[model samples]
Target: MGEGNWARVKIILRSPASRLKGVCADARFSGPVGRPAVAPVLCINGPEDKLFRSQSADITLSSEKERIKKMLSEGSICEMNLEVELFALQDSNAKLVAALHEANANVEQWKKQLSAYQEETDRLRDQVADLETHGGHGPSDLLKDELTQSLEELESLLKAKDEEIHILQSKKSEYHELERDRGEAIHRLQELEMRNMDLERRVQNAEQTLASSLEERDRAENEVHRVIDILDVKIFDLNDLRQSLAKLIDK
Candidate 1:
């Protein structure tokens, strides 16, 4: 089918033609008694002559048969080898396809997890914003104002002396309690901030993993295409070889 293959067929075809030409030339000049024979039938003069010619013809036919057998045997071996190689390539292609499917499944799973993480991150961000807005002027600010007013009252009460000492002590206890609550609220806010940072880091890692899996899938697909193309060319070559052998046999 290809120009190169056709050329090879032509070369193979010439061998048999050349062999036939040699046989013809031998019949014309190398006849019995060293005399040139115009035709094979004219060369025979007796039963012995006929016997010699028959024997020579039989030898030539036998040799040609053997040569043809040898060529066919070699071609069969080559075909077998090609078949084995084709089977191996097909197996490898199947494995690659399986791996590609597994990679696709993994990619899909990662996508789902990434989506979930993103939704959770968004929710956490919204909560952080709400806490910042409400808590900025909520319990902590109110407690600071109350503590400041209590300190002013205590300073003024200190000048009034012994009667109000007990009252001053009670206000001090309430101020310590409010300070502790503010510390706890700040601690909770810091923990939330830390949790948000960890989630962001996890989201970034998931994205990178997804990207890597996609690239690997692409590479696997390319390899499968390359193997398929190779198999096509090999099949073509095998067909061409079969056609050439058929023509040789016909000749």
Candidate 2:
């Protein structure tokens, strides 16, 4: 058993035994037979004395029984307290165990990360060694310088190309605007041409109407001249008839 449990057991046994010893002492003092007198002879003479002694013995016995009961109750309370403490300790131990498990899991994760880092470090070292073996130190330095110069040239070219692209984009916008203006001018020219065709057609129709009017005017003038000549001949005939009539009258 654990030290705490053992101590609790000892306490449980000790209290009851001590109280029993006190009870035994009381029983011995209350005995009426086979025991020596503890008081003076003059003090134990008559019926009153016997009654008093009996009452004293009864009181002592009752007090001893009560003490024994109290001791048993105290022992039971101690046992209950110990049990409560044991449960509390068990709960604490379970919590500690859980915490330890969590800590172990964290440690394992860190170890994995550390291992991956170590592998990366080894790879880098190997790459450095390979680079060293492939070329002498001066060659590596020259290669580094060449790579840096190439990068700078590439960057400069990219910047120049970007500027060219910007200029082209601006020119493209201007071309688009010019194209739109040309389309508008073409549309206006088409409208003017249509208007000119309509005006030409109107002039042609007016000329045809004017020709028909001229032909009708000539026909009317010729009919008028023929009528005037016929009138002149009739007048001359009437004058001749008048002269013939005058000669007959004279006869």
Q: Which candidate gets the maximum lDDT versus the true structure?
A: 1
Clashes of 1: 0
**TM-scores of all candidate predictions against the true structure:** 0.37, 0.39
Candidate 2 ranges beyond 4 A from true positions: 1-141, 238-251
Clashing pairs in 1: none
Cα lDDT of all candidates, in order? 0.53, 0.51
The backbone clash count of each candidate, in order, is 0, 0
Q: Tell me the tens digit of each residue's lDDT in model 1 across 1-251.
A: 66777777667657876455434444444322232323133221343344454455556555555655555555555556555555555565556556556655755665575566556556655655676698784335644465456555555544544334454456456555545554554555455555556555555555555455455545554555565555445444444454446565565
